[model samples]
Target: MRRREGGARTGRGVGVLRVVVVGLMVTLVGRLWFLQVVSGDRYVRAAAGVSVRTVALAPLRGQILDAAGRPLVANRTVPVVSVDGVALAHQADGGRAVLGRLAAALRQPYGRLAGKIRMCGPGVARPCWPGSPYEPIPVADAVPVQVALQITERQADFPGVTTELRPIRVYPYGRAAGHTLGYLQAGVGRDGLEAVYDRDLAGRPGRRVVAVDNAGNVTRVVGQDPATAGNSLVTSLDARIQVIAERALATALARTGGTSGAAVVLESATGRVAALAGYPGYDPSVWTGGVTAGQYAGLQLLSRAVQGQWAPGSTWKVASVAAAANAGYRLDARYGCPSGYTVGDRLFRNFGSADLGTMTMRGALVKSCDTVFYRIADELWRRGSDVPRRTATGFGFGARTGIDLPGEAVGAVPAASARPGDAANFAIGQGGVLVTPLQLARAYAALANGGTLYAPRVGERVVRPDGTTVRSIVPPVTGRLPASAATLAFIRGALSDVPRSGTASAAFKGFPFGRIAVAGKTGTAESAGHRDTSWFASFAPDPAYTVVVVLSEGGRGAQGAAPAARQIWEGIDGLRETR
Candidate 1:
């Protein structure tokens, strides 16, 4: 009976083992069927999605044209050599062998070619690419057509290399209007007009759908969305005038041995900038490919016309006269014009210390009598009036002119004070009073245009690729002069006589007043340790053009800055004659 029971237990155990094995076999078959039939399409779609990529093709940058439709900053097409980083990765030797072959063909070093395609990360330096690893990296831009064709035709020898047409900035006038025209770096504007209107100049980028293999190598282009070109910017700049202004500035620097300077030509009535020039100018093209921080800093790319802050010297007399007149001082009444005027412990002497006795405010302006204006400032200070500061602010001084450019300097104006020499210095545009060349031009423009102060306009309009108008740029009216029409008229008459018989007369000795009657002021402000700052601010009453020239560390406004203005005025006269 015991033997029979043991045999039954063994049989039962064997049966249970067989049942468990069958159950596992059924479960495996079910899982296999589910994978093959239920979710097969989903997995396949995911795998295909992993192999596709969409590339962004940058649009053709718009042209920056002058008022007469001449291009100051335009684009030129050139062949660009690029490498597919992903395809290079799939190469048998990790793209090294491919890059070596490419470097040999392109006349570049193997290391440089390899560096151009390397993904940028911590510890990686440029020449390294900056975007996604899948994007084609530009190895060389502006390559010759023959070299580009050689690489493209010999695809088997140089795998993953490509030649494409790319648009780049070209300055037709060279460095003529460098400051105003600005420049682009890697499709982004750096300063001036370029920075202000970058969005309008850089149009929408297009999409390019491409396919890649499992190894992340691009196989073929599938589809593309055509790019839309940017709208062209039309500026008020006259190309010829811009060239003339730059040439005149160069002449001034050479003649006066000035370290640096700025020049501006503005439409007095409309507030349109005709020509804006700056010294220590550079070719905008240098920023095309790339520039290191050291290289850029060494360029000294500041725009003195809009960014320079310097004392107006006697040029501040215009504002001072207005300030005094508006503060109830008589424009027709006579004031003392001594060789020097004392305030507290300081004595402010006239230029060359020559006194012309006593004269009206108008005569003081023509003579640029510092003592008379100093008295006006002293009186205003004694009365506790803010007329000087208010007049300066009203005339667009001690502040930005709100010109449509980046990096404009908001010049400083000291608060109202009775600190002895402070009022006298402030009245003569000395002490802490400061103004930019552009600001001075705008102020003179307002004086010439019946006291309508406008925010200087450089960009005139924006036009689409199809020649439709995007919008017209209208310079906003910033403010009106604080003085009355009679006070302004008297000031205008005095300024009109300045170039004819006053302080600037020597500089305008032979200037053709018959063709265009010119009016302006001459200023030579002391610049601390450096030489005096030379300034000449003038305008044509009839045609209404305001021209201002300033020379840093250049002595005598009548000697340095006025001559530059005269040269520019001569050129302008010629322009007017031709018209």
Candidate 2:
């Protein structure tokens, strides 16, 4: 009985001990649950602050092409050497040394790279900035394939350096199509067609937030979407003709000693701008280098050829003829050229200050008779401003041509003037008259296309990647000629005679455009300081192509501008002969 009692006591003691241990374990488990589940976010953020890193993925840029599907602008992928400031923050000594070496290789100040490193930190979600990866911090953009290969070969040496492909704009034609095609910088469009179509020309930038390891090495990518590139823009410019016009126009500018010059060649039937050139052109590729404030200032300072305007000289006479012809005035209407004509208070003299006697309406254009045109202007405006204004409107003059370009200004051909003297100027395209090279082209297109003023097109078409048409331009008829068809032909015939005997005789040199019945008109206007602005508006085969040349701050229209017109006409003739 004594042994049985002792064994029972020992069993009770052992049971109590087991209960105590179980209770202790329950308390420890509850504390652990509270720390892990309830306070998880705080601890996780703390851990991520040191370990997580992110990188950016830039989208591929769109392509730019000429009318013939030729690549006027191309893309290149360059390797960029970038440093993660957050990655480099923990490794300042090593980063500083690496940056110094990179700066030396790129011949830049080390502080530039250092400043870039400071912008990126462990706090940043993504450390890859698109520009300079090292200082301003740059890795390289659209890196050369050889450099990419070199990076691949020496991948071990470049720890934080990343080599990626990004699209950059390259002008294959050099400065040939500079003003028309414009350029892309960091895939952003600037000026001309590029600026006009920026939304379609530039793609969206993408982002990827990569989760890095404890060592600042990217472990896995997370919570990021790939970037999409911008769509391409195709221009209406013909590459071959663009080159020809640029070369010829540049040569003309050099020879003329004029302030500056511009040319516009259009398909008369379709109103397609074949070539638009502004001389002393700036390279569109220079934009890719990022236009320096100095360069931008230089471009801004350039104030001739394009935005500059002068008297259209005698070219105003064509508007006079078109006005009279369209107004049911006879082409054979008789007018006598005197020593000079007195209108308002000023006396208008012939070009050489000499007088030609009696001239028929067509004969007036042949001799560019000032008195005859002055008399006609008196007749048109003498009754009222309606005749001159109506005639100018029909030819699409004194207005913006509504071209698909930026910075176009509507020239001044005021319907109502401050004085009657302004009326005299209106008849001659003088006082308060302003028009652009683009405007002149559109007006000439009207003459070429039987008075149909189609909307001018530069961006011919935009075709989407999915084989859908993004946008398409259509033809438009602004207004009809004021004259009957016969009258229009009569005016056209007078214009035709211009190349043979009038102010434009020097333009064709010896070209046989007469066989095709090319019609044209020449204009010369002089301002207060004896400044000259010369013009030639020509169209061949009725509705084919039309070209307009305007030279500002030059000599007489027939003497200075006519030679350049001849060269262009000769080019057309050569092309036509071969065809």
Candidate 3:
């Protein structure tokens, strides 16, 4: 009976084991059906997500053209060599052997190439590619076509190396207008018009969704969007005038032994900057690949035209004379022309300490008599009015001229609490007064244009790729001079006399004034360690151009800065005759 009972239990156990085994098979079949039919598309999509990649296509940077539609800043296509970090990672020993072969072919250091391929790994120094690990890193740019061909033909050796045509920024004029047009680095603008209008110059970048393998190799292009080219920037710069200005400035600096200088020419009526030149100019192309520490350091001493500020010297006398006239000091009224004037404990002397007896205000301006202007400033200071400061501000001094280029400086003017000594100094454009070449140019332009002070402009217009005007830059009037027609006329006549028979007479001794009708002011400001800062602010009536020049540590305005201005005028004359 015990044996029979045991047999029944064993049979029941066998039956239960068979049922459990069958249930397991059925469950496996159900899961297989659900995976293969119900969720197959979802799994496939997940797999694709692991392989697909989106790449940002860089747009073609716009061309910066002069007013004549000639390109100052343009683009060139060059061959670029890139490395796939993902593919390199998949190799045995993390692509060390492959990278070694590449370094040998390219003649680059193995460690540098490795560091560029790695994505900020521990113990790796910078200049590492600041990009995704799955993306191809640019190892070399602007490489020779032969070098690119070598890598392209030897795919097996260079597993994931890519050769592509990349756009590089080019400056046709080179260092001619370097400071005005500025430079770019890694497809971004640095300074000048480049930085100010970067949004308009740098177009919208495109995108591409591509199917890539685990090795980061593009299997196929799934989707793409074409990049739009940037709009061409039409600048107010006249390339020919710019070249002439640069050559003239360079020649003057060489002749005077001056360390630095600046020259600017503006359209008197429109306030359009025709030529802006800075001494010790740099090549914008140097910023293309990358600038070295030494190369960048050299550029610091340059770019002084719109950026450098100094006392306007006698050039500020133009503003002072106008202020005096507006404040009811008669243009024809006579004042004593002494060699020096005493204000408190200080005695301010003229350029050569010459006394010309008593003379009218116009005579004072022509001779640039410091003592005559000192009396007017003293009278105004005693009355305690802001006419001097107001007059200077109205003519665009003591503030930025709102030029299109970057790094402009707003010159300083004395406050209402200024003392008689300060006022006397300010009258001669000395004391705490400061002015940039650009600011002085604008002020002189306002006088030339009959009281309209237009904010200076560099960019003229923007053009689309299809040759349509995006927008035009109309020269906006910032402020109008408070001086009336008679006051402006009197000042204009006095300025005309300056180049003809006044302080700047020696510089313009042989200049043909019949056709041009040149008018100007010469200034010499005292410096602590150097000789003086020379200045020349001039304008023409016929063709209507305002030119301002400054020489740091230069001896005399008539000798140093005036000659440069004369050369520029000669260039303008040549341009006109040719036209």
Candidate 4:
């Protein structure tokens, strides 16, 4: 009986021991579940707080080329110095002394570095800087490779400072055709063709998921996303021809005491814009790579020709003549500009303030008599605005040119408000109207090409990186001038007589360029402060080319703009003969 009692007590003690062991295992599993599943996101946050680091990869920018495949805007390998703003914050123990050390290493002004670092403040716990932790601070751009190498060698002391290979836009031709090529900023297109073709020019950016250690240091590259470089584009501008136009315009502007100037050369048959130049033209390289504050201020002051709308002066006469011819108006009809004619309530005065007795249509044009055009404008107004408006549209007036560039404007012509003064002013290229130098160039091309108004094309082609021809720009015939053969002949004869007998006669009297018959007209438009928009548009040798030059504030078309046109003709003829 005693042995049975002992056995029962032993079994109960063993059962208690088994239950305690099971309880211990259950407690351990519950604690593990609480620590892992309940707080998984929190642990991830802790890991990121200690070990995530980011890096940036840049893409290549496209090349801008001119006609004949010469590079106008190109990309060159350049060394740029930058710093991971976030990395510097904690690595340099709040980055206070890191700024001074970085200044010494970069050999830059200590104060400038300090100023930037302080502005960044402290990027700990959360960022105190303007951008995210991955954002880089541009310490300096386009540093010399050797200088960058030296800085990199001592990067241990500089902490987060880095040197990378960057592509920099280079303009080998200076400000040759700045108004057309435009500029780039922050790997993005800012103005002109650069802005218009930003997507094509700025290639795709690459990225990588880098592995970082507990100290927020990049331990490995991990994986990479490769980047592709931008393609190359060819424009219609010829650097050599552009140089000629710029030199001529500058000399003319200086001689005329003009505030601004512009010029363009177009192919008569194809309507290709050979060269388009503007003065007081800003250097394209300055705006693209980087510009000083003072240079930027100066650019702001002279940003006119690209955006300025001005009275086209005598250049508008081309559109008027086209309109007149299109309307089948008598070209040889005699008209009188006796002192001045009355239009509406305004008494319009002749340019010379002298009476031009009854003269034929040809005589009216050669003499540039305000009275002749006045009567013509009145006739058009009487014929209804349709004839004139249609004529202007045919000539590409008041229409924005679809050039492969940004920030272009189509100047205005009078709407059918039917004001009498506008009619008279219309005859004189005044009232609510304006035209760009480019428009005059293209219209003159039509006159040279027997009245086939072709669209103005600027780019030649864009070659992809894979060696495929991506695009080739071709100009299209937009409109035609419907006129009698007799009227056309009469108008052509008068235009030829311009250099032969009119105001431009004195300027081109010598005919130094030889038997290349050139027909042109000169204009002087009135502006504020006695400033004038002087103009000269012409076509030479019929089958060859047409050149148009318009100057603003450039004294007189007779003494100012005309002489420049002559020089341009001389240069063009000389170059052609030599070639």
| Root-mean-square deviation per candidate | 5.7, 7.7, 6.3, 6.2
TM-score of 2: 0.81
lDDT of 2 by residue, 356-436 (tens): 778788888777777777776766666764776777776777665677766666666776664645666677677777777
By lDDT, is 1 or 4 better? 1
Model 1: per-residue Cα lDDT over 1-579, one tens digit each: 999999999999999999999989999988988887897865775777546788887799899999999999999988988888887777888878778877887787687677667787798876566776667787877888888999989899888888998887888999877888776564233787888899999999998887766767667888999999999999999999998999988898888889999999999999999999999999887776566545676885789999989998998888888888878888889899999988777888877898889898889989888889877787778778888898888888878888998899999889876577798899988999889999999988888889999999899999998889999999999899888899888988999888899888988998899888998899999988999999999998766799999999878888889989999999988988899
Identify the superior model by TM-score, candidate 1 or candidate 2.
Answer: 1
Q: Candidate 2 at 578: error in angstroms?
A: 5.2
| lDDT (Cα, tens digit) per residue for candidate 4, span 212-309 | 65666666676778777877777777788889989999999888888787777888888787887788887777754344334455773233433556
TM-score of 1: 0.89
Off by over 4 Å in 1: 1-42, 45-50, 92-115, 121-127, 153-157, 186-189
Each prediction's Cα lDDT score?
Answer: 0.86, 0.67, 0.85, 0.73
Worst 10 residues of 1 by lDDT: 181-190
Instruction: Indicate which candidate wins on TM-score.
Output: 1
Deviation (Å) of 274 in candidate 4: 1.4
For residue 199, model 3's alpha carbon misses the true position, in angstroms, by: 2.4
lDDT accuracy of residue 299 in candidate 2:
66
| Total clashes for model 2 | 28
Better of 2 and 3 by TM-score: 3
Full candidate order by lDDT, most accurate first? 1, 3, 4, 2
What TM-score should be assigned to candidate 4? 0.83
Candidate with the larger lDDT of 1 and 2: 1
